[model samples]
Target: MSDTCSNVQGYVDPNWPRPDDDGSSCIIIYGYVPSFALGVLGVVLFTTALVAHSYLLSRYRTWYFSTVIVGTVMEIIGYIFRILASKKNPYSVAYFVGQYFCIVVAPVFYSAAIYTLITPMTKRIGREYAPLSPKVILWTFIICDIIATTIQMTGAGLIGRAYSDGKDPTTPNNILLAGLAFQVFSFAVFIFCLLFFLVRSRNTTDRHFKIFSTAVLVATLAVYLRTCIRLAETAEGLLEFLSTHEAIFGCLEFLPIVIAVYIFVYWHPGRWLGSESIHKKTGKSELEVSQLPR
Candidate 1:
């Protein structure tokens, strides 16, 4: 037994017989089943979202749906890496990097799509109600998303470097927490802005606009919930219960995102807001002025 332990060194290889609960080697022992299950579910949801976005693109010819598609693809790949990580080699550095990198940055694309929605919405309603012009809002929020993405990806890279060097990941984890907090703040401000527009708009009778706005609200809330969870999880540091526990991750991160993706698909703005025919026929001057990208 001593010979086997010495020969294996510090690594936990999945091909070898399972090792005893030595506090130093294994991060998780029996939670692979649940991880695999959640990973599979994530793949399925993201794939469905991808297909839906593709169909929307072919019919609507909107560039914004492509952003959602990119996010879905990232999510699918991220979960695939998580499934690999669940195969008894939870300590595998490759799997860890793949999962965290893709998952953490994927939502930035979704936020970009959300930001695009505001342009047409402000045009459809009234530009006066918005604090900034639609084009300004679009660029501002998308740039914020880019900054958040860079911060989170840098933190993930730092964490990977620290892991490889056998150093403490606390600093990188704090960086990740900052990125998550930034996302939460951005989404919160976005929601407030949307609410302000909703309250101030005189054209509330448009059912399609109302439904589209509701969908955007729900999706934003879902992402906001996930961001808050990630913020709390990372704020607790890598060794804490929220960071180590898989079930909590599945509930907070995975579930909220899946819900958000489905909401966007079912209530896709392109279906209503992207229709050139509807825009042309609209008697309202404000809605007529609203132009979706071809």
Candidate 2:
């Protein structure tokens, strides 16, 4: 799509002398007016998460969880841009790109934070049961995350350039799609490995390990769901149903992320695994009640 909003496929009439002259003339970059209410809600939830994470950081010094800090900050910035896009110019390319980059890539950081879990988890359960060394697993996923984040950033820059220069957005869109899709795939693999590690070690673990693992699982599912929603929206083309619908975004994307962040706070790593005095040794991290720690 072009900055003039003329070339945007499935959107823009391309005949209007002034595309953003009025809402009637063009559907706008977002396809619909972003809700100020939801934007505000995003700010509130992410801000609260940031504050909670800050406290946890200070108290526990679990620096490995720094990725969550990065994630929350991105969410806050993204939502701020969203609020601006809603209140000011929904058609402004700058605002759209700002929110796009921050919101879309924030989960990359979250995935990194989640990936760190395997190292300690493996150590707790006996690394011999894991198919690969815990450090190897951690680094592998984190590297994949870095690669995905780089791709998203690269695509974001190119898309902005494309819009500004009145060039075709197809290339950038493809890049973004590939990046997001790969991230989702990597996460699915990570989940599989996590499950495999747990199932193979079916003995039992302490309460702390269970709580810590549960937090990761819940947060992981929420983030995974959010990413899947995003991938679907992007894959369908910018002006399609998922992209145009604010309600879908609110329910699927926004709600899940908020739940993910808050869930982590409630079952925080710092609260559970922070002390590291868990009394048990081995087990899986899944639905089997017997495998769960008492």
Candidate 3:
């Protein structure tokens, strides 16, 4: 099935490492099983979110669900490509382009989840302490994300070209390094701004602060950890023996984001904001706000 497998009309290369040679092997590292499994997971999660959104139409707005759906779709697409690649080991150039680009870029939609939080936080914390308006933050980062994504994808394409050509790995390596560097810088700025807002709003009368703040803090920490691991992996490039060390990367990048997803689902920003708005508009006393809102 693999192009590499087809090309080898001659005897198999004994020099190549066999699965039997190493005690350590996994579907993620040695076969297509991992991609298929992950793809299924993505589909299930995406479908669940869609159903949840449909039922909540009256309770929350479209954009809240839209971002999650889009992010889930990106993840689904990425894993699909991975599954395809698994079926054919020496996958086409487009396979590399599609899979890695989607995998990296999907996180942008994750940031969209972060954006949904702001609308609610704005109401709870008050506009004065919101650090900046939701509109400003949303448009600013989304636009920048577009630009950043373009750079990263373009770089990934070039890297794929390099690999296809069998050129020195340096060309693609540099592009990957550049993209990761920019991503780290972008996330660092976002973290700084978000942390500043939460700190300033800590003492505010917003009832949802306790829940929202904790959720946000957890999400921020997950992003931070994901970025750090990405930085290290990209920096080492092909030189590192652990490039495909499945479990480590999985625990760091995939696991944290999964945790963040559950945290967000638990927090459910739209519900928090809606309840807060109802409380304030009804002119309920601070003590009474708690008793009736939930």
Candidate 4:
């Protein structure tokens, strides 16, 4: 027993005792109690957002809300794993892997939801103001999101595998950095497109459109901020300051996403575009509305 324990002294395994236990020491400085508390808070908040999304879906029937719901669910699960890692065994590979993969990929779904909104919004406001057709814009950004998701997931898997195997993680870390960089670039482009649309359609007077557009802009900025943080965190590598620091993660990662989640909930697109669907109705009348112009 002593031999086995000594052999794995620098590594964490499922059979190892927690550091809080007598004669046991953690392989890494686990996340702090406050970090665990924050993870729990994230789970609760996301669950509430999920509930709100369901209610919105029932009334509005827009499939786009599903993306938000999925993203929230992933975030809740990711935080749950983060809480698990915060236990006396912070080096628990499974817990870290689960938390990292889920949390990082969760925002892609939010980006998708934002992209979905663009189609409906463009149609209602004026397609002429958009650089591309609604369908083209929707699919184009969704495809970019998919590409980013794939790269990040692949990189995460490689990093996790390398860590577990007690091998150097530099290659995988670089891959992860590349993936984060791509996501940051993609989000920047998406934000630019959104701003362009807003500027081009500034003449829109519909109250619902204004509210929906404002919500989208806020959500996009929040998500963009979070993405930039992630890019920096990844660039610093897994064991670096940003990666090890719970405070940075809580403030930059957890807070921004939660803000975006609430923004989407408060200004739910369904309220404007759902059953009794004002966006569709307004879109149909756009030709007539355009004749008057602003």
Candidate 5:
């Protein structure tokens, strides 16, 4: 605690660099002060997501959507911590780290929500359109998500320790980057699957497929935008321009995550994937694919 460079101390001083650091800059816990207004905006955005998701879950009973709610709650908690730190205790490491990683890993939960839709989507459109089985695709992304979350959480913990002990955070930062990198690669493969499915299914004329596909594409891309930015920011490390810049976090990270969770409000899975939906659309049953010749 005493080692904090200012309110929090820099491990590297620009004038007198650490043994390993380049002399160009220093590393500190927070590059700039946290903003109360931004934290409030985060809470408002996430709370709106929570309410919308909860309403959808209640009305449709798409229990899978609960993952989306869980992520929203975590985002709210993260913002609460941020709000507390913004004015009251900006230098408090507990609030700082808590706020940081909560937002960092919460995406994994909602990402799972999106990932699970692959099976239902394939069933609606036709399994043949995809190179891999929908279930296989679902499990693949889920497993990758679990691994990414684990790695990121472990790295977050090490980062806290690094700050407290005033030790080198290079290893922890690398661990975090590795996890984000893995997630990015997995998501890239998902984009391929989406595009492939769209191309193969383009000839089929199912209204539900169009809505479903568009929603999935929009939601997933929103998350991807946030994740890519996070990877860039973290790559810059603590106290660096990208890391400390609130504007980037608010505009890119928070906005995208909020958009991701809310997109489903209009495109709720139950509308297209529910048993009743099939009857509504075709007066039959759920139709992820074309009707068979009877």
Candidate 6:
């Protein structure tokens, strides 16, 4: 990480040659290219989801669509910085700033997606089956998610400042650790809530119900894995284990998120909305039929 130290020194003046013995080669920048590429792919997929949702405004929920839009935009911005970093070793301070900011905020929309799922889930599975009220799920997890996001952003800023000031930014690892731990805690609570409701509503059955339930479970599991991987990465700092294992990051972060995105795409609430109209005639709630959340 002395390379980062030297890079910071050279970055202040903006035109200095990169440190020759600092262990960072220009080629190292390209090492991040695949992540940037995957980020772009994420943007496209999320954008498609947004547009499809918006075009079928009557069929899709606004909160879900908006969250997708915002998450996509964040991924786009994150990739832009990644590309910049690819082009410039250590990258410009501004590029690093944007990358950290956007990536950190992206998970907030994920939390929003999680929140949006709760009320609809309660409606679908019957509120009585829900382990916690929609209000409780919303207020508690959303607040914790927000706190995690704030901690991450602040930690990223502190690390940046420390690096720029020629101090050991790794000392602020506790902030990042706290944020990740908070996120994991929130997600664990959510999983408990989901499982509680799901088990309670097991009698409600259908192919679609099964599919959506599996999708929700998969998404939750994916996020949990991503959270753990991030925690490991942060704990590792610039250690060789992290630096040499790019594929591990990809599998832990990208693959899980891809699974999540695809789950959302296929298990969208649109199909069920039509079926709900049928249930209206029977004077029964969709909750009685399917416990799946949107």
The better-scoring model by lDDT among 1 and 3 is 1
Give the Å shift of residue 47 in candidate 4.
0.8
Tens-digit lDDT track of model 4 for 122-166: 766778888888788888888888888988999998877876665
Give the C-alpha miss distance for residue 156 in model 3, angstroms.
1.5
Q: How would you encode candidate 5's per-residue C-alpha lDDT over 1-294 as one tens digit per residue?
A: 123344544433243332232211124355656678988988998888788888878876777567988888999999998898656555566776788789999998978898888766676667888889988888899899999999999998888777666678889999999999998889888888878888888888367768778888998999998889889977888667788777888889888988888788878887667644453466433343345565
Candidates in order have lDDT scores of: 0.73, 0.77, 0.59, 0.76, 0.77, 0.63
For candidate 5, what is the lDDT? 0.77
Candidate 3 Cα deviation (angstroms), residue 63: 1.1
Q: For residues 1-294, could you state the per-residue lDDT of candidate 6 as single tens digits?
A: 345454432212234344444223322321233355665565576567556545543454334435655665676677667665555544344566567667656756765675667675566557898887898888888788888988988887786665445566676767977897788888888888888888888888556666777777887787778777777777767333653455875677657765765666666654543234534464334444455554
> In angstroms, how far off is 60's CA in candidate 2?
0.7
Clash count (model 6, backbone only):
1
- In angstroms, give how far residue 215 of model 2 lies from its true place: 2.9
lDDT of 3 by residue, 1-294 (tens): 334334322222233332331221111222122355665565566556545644443354535535655665676677677666555431344555576677677676777667556665665567777667878876776676667667667767776665455445566667767766776777677777777777777787555557667778788678667766766876876435334544564577667766666665656655554544454576342334556856
Worst 10 residues of 4 by lDDT: 22-31
Model 1, range 203-233, lDDT digits (tens) per residue?
6537777777788888888888888887887
lDDT accuracy of residue 110 in candidate 3: 74
Q: What's the true lDDT of residue 201 in model 2? A: 75
Tens digits of per-residue lDDT for model 2 on 1-294? 335555445443243233344232233567776788988999998999999988987775667778899999999999998898777766667777888889889989888988887775776578887888988899999999999999989998787666655567778988999999999999999998987876777567766666667678888999999989989988997777998888998999889888888887777665655423232322323323344658
Which residues of candidate 1, in runs, are more than 4 Å off?
A: 1-34, 276-294
